[model samples]
Target chain A: MNIEEMTSMERVLATLCHEEPDRVPFFLLLTTQGADVFNVSIKEYFSKPEMVAEAQIKMQQKYGHDCYYPFYYASLELEAWGSESVFYPDAPPNAGRPVIKEFEDILSLETPDVFESPGLQKVLKTTEIMKKHSGEDIPIISVVMSPFSLASMQMGFENYLDLIYDDLDRFKELMRINESFCVQWANAQIEAGATAICYFDPVSSSTIIPPELYRKTGFRVAKRTISNINGPTATHMASGRCLPIVDDIAETGTAVICTSVLEDLSEIKTACKGKLSVLGNLNGIEMRHWSPQQTEDKVKEAISKAAEGGGYILSDNHGEIPYTVPQEVLTDISRSVKKWGQYQG
Target chain B: MEFEDTLLSLNRVAAKNIISSEFTGDNAFEVINEIISPTLERIGELWAHGEIALSQEYMASRICEELVETILPADAPSRKNMPVIGITTLRDEHMLGKRILSSFLKANGFNLFDYGDMGPESIVQKVKDDGIEVLMVSTLMLNLAHEVKKLRSSFDNEKIDTKIIVGGAPFLFDRNLWKEVGADSMAVDATESVEKIHEVLGDAR
Candidate 1:
């Protein structure tokens, strides 16, 4: 069957099941770029659920990708801990400052009610709006940060490392708090109509931590959190290389894993065969400057490497598409995927 | 106290004792160059190869930073004088790389203006205002890495002769990114930044 014969929902479901779909599924991960499509400032777009839903629908219609990621930004998760996000006119919002200034602050930190946090509520509302609009046709991909990764943002990365070395018990205590909040927030999104959760956990990546450390700390947090997610989960390291710890990632029981541009797609596909589906490896950093031809070439290359046997979703290695990418580049990706992403019996 | 082992094990007390006992005033630079710099470099290599975790490398760098400050303060009389240098993370909040690079340079007796985290426009103005001859920019994200081009354009528009050197994950991922962004050179790690600085400055040092 041609890709046109299948709904985006069916296509993604098929790929997740490790069955050949009409064609390879792809997600553009238009997180911040959705604001540009909606013609609103990022701060405004994130605040208004209707606009975010409308923008995501418009982006899906424009690019014809298979997934709807109703995400605002990573920093929104940190907001539940009283961390503020700094909005930029031309860039995605960044976490302002470390909320946990001193190590002792972790002792008083509490797991926030996801429903009460304004930023998180906005995300949940956006997910609900998208599900209401395109629930039956598109797969809504919601995101939740791993407690290990969130610990870095709660305190500065350096401070987090210091905490780990200074007081392992406090670090673990902080992780417990973050894990509770993550589970609550993730289940809330599932209740809000998300089909699957993308667990964004860059701190666990080999780019940040070695496999042994991940096995000792991040792996345990992921395993416990994922088991309680109440929905399918895809592990993503946000462009951080995962090959070194791919086995540990698979052991987390996530249904899918997003590979980084730093690793070979074929190697990851081979490593993940029969274990977890793979989605991505495209270099989002360089995609902005790529010509349509270059974009198509990359799409074909990724498809040729990982799309066989139907366990892959073509996407940029980084979970979020930068706003700097030109519309033509995205258009070319959509066109190229449809043209070259078809599977043979 | 095994300084290298203590650094790797993230043992701050042992590292401090070793530094205090071995780092006399005259041997400050020698101690850093021979022991601390190489140890950190080895840790960086271990991280690059996935032998040790980033937490190890980070804590090691932090420990070294604290100890090095006591031995060789930024305003020490032994600071270099010729070419004015500056480093900053343009529009990026990830300061580990920048911090590591700054401490490494300071350990090597180079006096550089640490601009912390600033955007392209402010960074450009500061570069011009300080008459910085060599600027090192570190960025963790790709979008912020492109800001180097903006800084370079501003420098050219203002005719500032400051040579730009960039290092970070983005530059490491894309080998030719430094050249594309109009950088004078690129360093793979903090250790290389010192060599690149000397290379970019030539006899200006």
Candidate 2:
């Protein structure tokens, strides 16, 4: 179907199936950029999911992109675990001192059910409200963070690194709880009517943790989280170090892999081929602030190289589009993709 | 408890024995440069090859830092009417580099206030509170534009004249970025830091 005929959901589903739906799909991460969508304070945006959804929907309606992600802050998980974190205007909440102060606290740790937990329930409620507002038109992603990333939140990033060597068996127990939480949370969102699960493991980037250690300690949990999810899934792995082990993550049955600009898009295309649909590598970090003409040129560059066939989605790859970037400058990316990312078939 | 045996076995006990007894004055600096630097570099190579994990690397780095501390001459800090330097790694940046850099500064006869792990604001406040002359910031990640920019702005607003020196992996990402972020000068390694500070401060003088 052509762009005019297919609804947002149809276009995205078609692309995920490796079929061209008249134009390339635009699925952007609207982080602090949502501030402009509402023109309200950042506090309101974080406090109310309705505001967050409204900002996302406005962008969706404006850009006519193929997907929508209900906004989530990485700090919400930390809050649920009984840690105090301070939130910046645009960034996610910062993990203060570790919540797991003692080994006994870790032993008493239990994976809170998503439906019952307050923090996750708030997110689930937000997704439900967002899905209702969008009328289930596009692929609304429930952003599920990786277990390892959540584990870092509980004990602080530096402390978790030390705990791995300080107490290996105890650390494995922590990993087990974290994985259980990831699966429960993602599955709950799927049940809450999210069309797909977007599994993001920002920490698993081999730069922070060696690939062998990542795979041995927590890769299985990552695999279980992705494999157990009921619907289509996508993953965004950050850092240049993550490039070496992208295929290992790709093997975990994620349908789509979103790459940062640090890796060669052509290399990733070669690596995933038929198995994984690819998104991002638009130099979104720097390009989001460029002029519309510049944004179009970068989009064209990505298209010519990575969009030879179907199965490629246009994305910026960052967690949240910075608020400083103009909305028009970003929409210009999809506008350029439609112009350049068309298929002959 | 010999240096050769410690180098082979990675034993801190043997290395500490040599650092404690047969080291003084100029000979102390030479032995550490020849012995400690090579051992740490080898460990760093193992880390680069993924032969060791981050925790193991941290422990190894701690051993080196302790060795440097134990070997310092009793009269080193008291002898200096030197510029007071404050050093810290940016919040979340690795501490191994900071430990090494501070050792180099201490070795060069500077009075340093080592503020272990601090965010941009805390370090800036420490600079103001401690009457710090030179501020050293180390960041491992390539993106520290926010931290560096905020620190520069804070120093300016507070009317503080602290000279900023930056090091670590990110500063090396772009040659001119350190200056762009308002650093007075930049250093690539521990030893270069000592020389760079003296040169920059001497020029200011």
Which TM-score values does chain B get in all models?
0.88, 0.67
In every candidate, what fraction of the native interface contacts is reproduced? Answer: 0.44, 0.09
Candidate 2: tens digits of C-alpha lDDT, residues B1-205: 2453364344778767776676665565566666766555565556455454444445555566667666655355543566788887767434556765665565444578988778777787788889888888876543453477788888899898898889875554346668777888998656466667777687532
Model 2: how many Å of interface RMSD? 5.1
Q: Give the clashing residue pairs of candidate 1, or none.
A: none
**Cα deviation in Å at residue A171, candidate 2?**
1.1
Q: Which ten residues in a row have the lowest lDDT in candidate 2 chain A?
A: A237-246
Name the docking class for model 2: incorrect
Model 2 achieves a DockQ score of 0.22
Model 1 residue A139 CA deviation in Å: 0.8
Error of 2 at A238 (Å): 3.0
| Candidate 1 Cα deviation (angstroms), residue A67 | 0.5
The residue-by-residue lDDT of candidate 2 on A1-345, one tens digit each, is 346677777777777787777677777777556766777666566677767777778877788777777746666776667765565565444555677877668899987766665767767777887788767577888787788777766765556666764688888788788878878778788877789887777667654566777777656767877777788788776433355666777778888888767567888877777888888776544653478888888888887777766778878765556554566787787689788877666
